[model samples]
Every structure is written in C-alpha cells, then in structure tokens.
Target chain A: MREVFQQSLREVQERLVKIAELVEDAIENATSAFGNSDVAIAEKVIDDVEEIEALAAELDLHAIDILARQQPVASDLRLVVGALRMSASLERMADLAQHIAQLARYRYPESAIPKGLTKTFVRMAALDVEMAAKLVELLRTQELDVVAEIRDLDDDLDELHAKVFEKVLSDKLANNPTGVVDATLASRYHERFGDHAVSVAKQMQFFLSGSLD
Target chain B: MREVFQQSLREVQERLVKIAELVEDAIENATSAFGNSDVAIAEKVIDDVEEIEALAAELDLHAIDILARQQPVASDLRLVVGALRMSASLERMADLAQHIAQLARYRYPESAIPKGLTKTFVRMAALDVEMAAKLVELLRTQELDVVAEIRDLDDDLDELHAKVFEKVLSDKLANNPTGVVDATLASRYHERFGDHAVSVAKQMQFFLSGSLD
Candidate 1:
C-alpha cells in the first residue's frame, strides 16, 4: 500500500512539473506575442489553453484519488493537498497568459499598447518569462532560493507596472483614451501573472518547510 | 470515531460560514466607504483583513485535520477538499474587498473614481454587496438555484464594468488620466469579486451534483 501511495505521489509530482513547463511555455509565447505584436503567436497561446485546463482537471482527480485510497497523512497528505492548489494556481497563470494573448489579438497589426511604452512592457515580459522558468525549477526542486527569486521578480514586475502607468499619465506623452485603458489593463495582467507565480511558490514553500509564512 | 469526525466536520462548516459572513461584512463596509468616500470605514475594513486571513488559515488547518485523521472518502472527502478551495476563494474575495477599501483610503478626502462616474460605481458597489450576501447564503445552503443567481450577478457586474470603461472613454466625459486608471481598476476589483463568488458557487454545485460542469 505504501508503495502504491508513493507511486501515485510521484505521478502527481511528475504531472505537476509538466504543467509548470507548459505554463512557462505559455508565458514565453504570450510575452513574445505581446512584444512583437504577433497575432499568430497570440492565437497559438489562446488555442493551447484548453490542454492546460484539461491537465489541471486530470491532476486534481489523481490527487483526490490518492487521498481517498492511500489516506496519506502528515507530509504525504500535505503533498497531495498542495498539488491541488498548485495546479489551480498554474492554471490561473495560464489563463493570465491567455488574457495577454487575447489583448494582442484584439489589437492585431496594431500593438495593444502604445509605441512609447513598448520598451517597458517588453522588459516586463522578459522578467515574467524568466520568473516562469524559475517556477518550473521551484516545482522540480522545491528550493527556497527559487521561491525568493520568484518574489523578487514579482517586485520588479510591480515596479514596471507602476512605470507603465506613470508614463501613460505623464504630460510629456499623449495617448488617446483607448491606449490608456489597454496599457493599464495589460500592465496589470503582466504584473498579476507574477503575483500568481509568487503565490504558487509560497504554497510550495509552505508545504516543504511547514511554514505558512 | 465516526461521531467525532462528523463533529469536526460540522465545526469546519460553521467556521466556513463565519468566514463567509465576514467577507460579506467586508464588502458592505468597503463599498460604503467607497461610495461615501469615508476614510474611517475604509481604514476599518483594511485593519480587519488580518482577521479574515487568520480565519481562513485556521479553516484550512481544520479541514486538513479532518482529512488526515478521519480519512474521509467519497462524499465526505469531496466535502473536505471543496471546503479548502471554497475557503481560498473566499479569502481572495475578502482581499479584493480590502483592495477596494485601500483605494478609497488612498484617495481620502476625494473619491478615487471621478465625479462623473460615481453614480455608476455606486450602483456597482450595491450589486457587489448583494452578491456577497448571496455568497453567504450559498455557502450555508449549497443550493443550485443560488449558484445560478450568483452567475447572473456576475454577468450584471461585467456589464457594469464595461459601462465604466465606456463612460471613461466617452467623448462627453472629461476625467483626468488618474481618474481613468482608478475607475478602470476599481471596476475590475468589483467584477473580480463577483467572479470569485461564482467560482465558489460552482465548486459547491459540483460537490452536491458530482458533476464538474
């Protein structure tokens, strides 16, 4: 019975890593799409969202099955429960990526964001993609350093988000109302993508260290 | 053992309902503060957020105990897992409410939103408070009809959110750039509050019906 439980637990972990990788891909593609104003890449990200959702659902059921059949306790039980949350968090990150893609798609040939502000958004996207890669590492290793790095990346994203707004509201640059709203919402999407990554990292850290903080 | 498990489960349910009620209160106070531009009420809501976070953590620990010690299966297992997710969704809802309060507090002595759009925001706040009340009921009842009602409320909120953006971008209205951004984010917070409520209702519905749709 213990062997079966361990086997199922390994399966859950492996699937979780796979989901993390997919989320990384989604972020990378979404950012590239946004930066390049490439509608095709954006469409691709949107198209691939269903697979991530399907995987999340499958992982959830597998976790529940382990809980029911193996009746894991202590660290093992925490692993199972935490998997459910991690999958949900990753799925949400994927959805945010898709939202970024949709923004690119909405504007098509014209960038969703204004030209003057594109450099900041491009930097934000790069930072986010780097953070997503770190998330894949954190999931696989469960290292505290990776978690800290993700937190720092989120801080940078937050600062970038603020800069985006600062530029938009500055009198030196003038964008129409539509540009203002789109830039505001897009910057928020990128920043929030990092926030979700941080939340997942915190959850994993809590599970491994037995500390909720 | 069975009686004790059921009793603990009951405690978990009671605490969850209490959290729901607190979230409802947070929404009420936050909106009142926003509508009246009352910094005091907004500060009260912000200060009280830790209580809700602490309650959510306690509920999570309690639910974990029920799972680890009781080894609940099938329906009981579903209830335990669902409680974890439901508590999370509720905690996030409360955070959104606190964010609303923070926005009000940030722009104290003046509304965060523009004067031209205050009436629309007032209406949105009222709808959000109504939706929060329904969330309390749904948590207590787990009724399918309540889930349907929450969905309708979210739709209404989405429409209101769109109206907010529309009004901001309209030619007639003249909001400064800061007003446009604040209104955009505040509308999004209210809309997301409802989205969380709907997600909680859907989780409960799935638990009762054993269908993931």
Candidate 2:
C-alpha cells in the first residue's frame, strides 16, 4: 500500500511537470507571437489552452482520488494538495498566454508593443518565457533555489511592467490611444504570466518546506 | 467519526462564509473609494486584505486537518476541496478590490474614472458589488440560483469591460493619456474581480453537483 501511494504521488508529480512543459510552450509561442505579430503561432497558443485546462482538471481529479484512497498524511498529503494548487496556477499561466496571444491576433497587421516600448516589451516577454522554463524545472527537480530565482525574475517582470506604464504615460506614445491600450493590456498579461509562475513556485516551496512562509 | 467530520465540514463552511463577508466588504469599500477617490477608504481596503489572507490560510489549514483526521470521501471530500478552491477565489477577489482601491489612491485629488467613462465605470462597480453580495448569499445558503445570477452579472461586467476599451480608443479622451492608462487598468481590475466571483460560484456548483460543468 505504501509503495502504491508513493507511485500515485509520483504520477501526480509527473502530471504537474507535463502541464508545466505545455505552459512553457504556450508562453514561448505566446511571446513569439506577440513580439512578431505571428497570428499562426498566436492561434496555436490560443487553441492549445484547452488541452492544458483539461489536463489540469484531470490532474486535480487524480489528486483527489489519491486522497480518497491513500489518505496521505503530513508531507505526502501536502504534496497532493500542493499538486492541486500547482495545477491551478499552471492552468492560469496557460490562460494568460492565451490572453497574450489574443492581443497579438487582435493587432494582426499592427504591432502591439506601441512606438517606444518595443524593446521593453521584448525583454518582458523574454523574462516571462524564462520564468515559465524555470517553473517547469522546479516542478520536476524540487530544487528550492529555483524558487528564489523565479521570484527574482518576477521582480524584474514587475519593473518592466511599471516601465511599460511609464512609457505609456510619457510623450513618446502620447497620441496613440490604441497603442496605449494594447501596451497596457499586453504588459499586464506578461506581468501576470510571471506572477502565476511565482505562484506555482511558492506552492513548490510550501511542499518542500512544509510551510507557506 | 461521521459526526466529527460533519462538525468539521460545518466549520469549513462557516470559515468560507466569514471570508466571503470580508471580501464583500472589501469590494464595497474599494468601489466606493474608486468612484469617490476617497483615499481613507482605499487605505482601509488595503489594510484589511492581510486579514482576509490570513483567514483564508487558516481555513485551508483547518480543511487539510479535517482531511487528515477524518479521511472524508465522496461528496464530503468534494466539499473540503471545494472550500480550498473557493478560499483562493475569494482571496483573489480581495486582491482585485485592493487593486481597484490602489488605482483610486494613486490618482488622489483626481478622479480615476476618466471624463466620459464615469457612468460606465459606475455601472461596472455596481455589478461587481452585487456579485460579491450574491456570492456571500450563495456561501451562506448554497442556493444554486445564485450561481446563474452571478454569471449574468459577470456577463454584464464583461460588456462594460469592452465598452471601456471602446471609449478608451475613441476620441472622447484623446488628450488625457493618464486617464487612458488609469481607465484601462481600473476597468481590467473591475472585470477580473467579477471573474473571480464567478470562479467561487462555480466551485460551489461543483461541490453541490459533483461536477465542474
């Protein structure tokens, strides 16, 4: 029974890693789509989100089933509960990616990065993609150091988010209301993608340390 | 043991209701502050978020303890799991409220609602507050009808969200870039607040119906 429970826990971990990988792909494609205004890649990210959501729902059901049958205690139980949360965060990450992709699709013939903020947005997208990759790594390896790295990446993303706002408000894009709206929404999406990655990292931290702090 | 589990479940329900009540208060105060640009009320909403966060954490701990101690299966298990998800949604709602309040506070002595978008924003804020209240009622009573009502409210809120974008892109606020940024973010925050409320309602539906659909 103990071995079976351990196996179920392993299954949970594998599913989380799988979802995280898909999320990484989604964000990568999303950023590429946003930066280059590639509607095909954007559409792919948008279409693939359902797969992530379905997988997340399936993982959640599996975790619940484990709790029902095995009744894992202490850290084992935390792992299962944390799996549920990680799945939610991963699912949210996919949603944000889709949102980013939609922005690209919305501005198909035009760029979403506005006039003066293209470089800033490019850096922000890179940061989000990097954070998604680190999240996948953390879920697979359980390395606590990766958690801090993810947080630091989020800090940088937040700064870029602020910078996007600053640029939007500056005279550089003063007359382009459409650019202002797109940049505002796009930057917000990129920043939130990083935030959800940090959320997944924090869940991993809780499981590793058995404390949310 | 069954009776003890029942007691624990009741405790979970009560805790969720408590948190929902606080969330209701947060959004109410937040919208008021946002509509009025009242820094004092915004400050209150900001300070109160930590309490909601702490309560949510405590409730999660309690739900996990119940699972550990009683090993509830089937519907009872669903209830506990649903509580965890609902707590997360409610906490997110509180954060969104805080975001709205921050928008108001940031634009102090100046209206966060741009010149022509004020009426639309007022309607959006009203819808959010109504949804929060309905969520509280749903948590307290478990009436499924409230779910449909919340969904309808979200639909209205989403329309207003699009309307805000339309107005932002129009020539109405052509020269006010600050107003454009603030309206964009504030509208997004309000829309997201409604989305989180719908999430909570869906969780309740899952608990009662044994399916997420």
lDDT of the candidates, in the order given: 0.87, 0.91
- State residue A165's C-alpha deviation in candidate 2, in Å: 1.1
> Every model's DockQ, to 2 decimals?
0.56, 0.81
| Model 1 chain A worst lDDT window (10 residues) | A171-180
Scored against the true structure, residue B70 in model 1 reaches a CA lDDT of 86
The TM-score between candidate 1 and the true structure equals: 0.96
Which model scores highest in DockQ? 2
lDDT of 1 by residue, B66-116 (tens): 888888887778889988998889998999999899888988888897868
Show where candidate 2 strays beyond 4 Å. none
Using TM-score, give the best candidate's number.
2
Interface residue Cα RMSD of candidate 1 after superposition: 2.2
lDDT tens readout by residue for model 2, A92-203: 9999999999999999978777877878988998898899899889988999999999999999999999988888888887778888888888888888888889888998
- Candidate 1 - CAPRI tier? medium
Q: How well does chain A score by TM in each candidate?
A: 0.96, 0.98
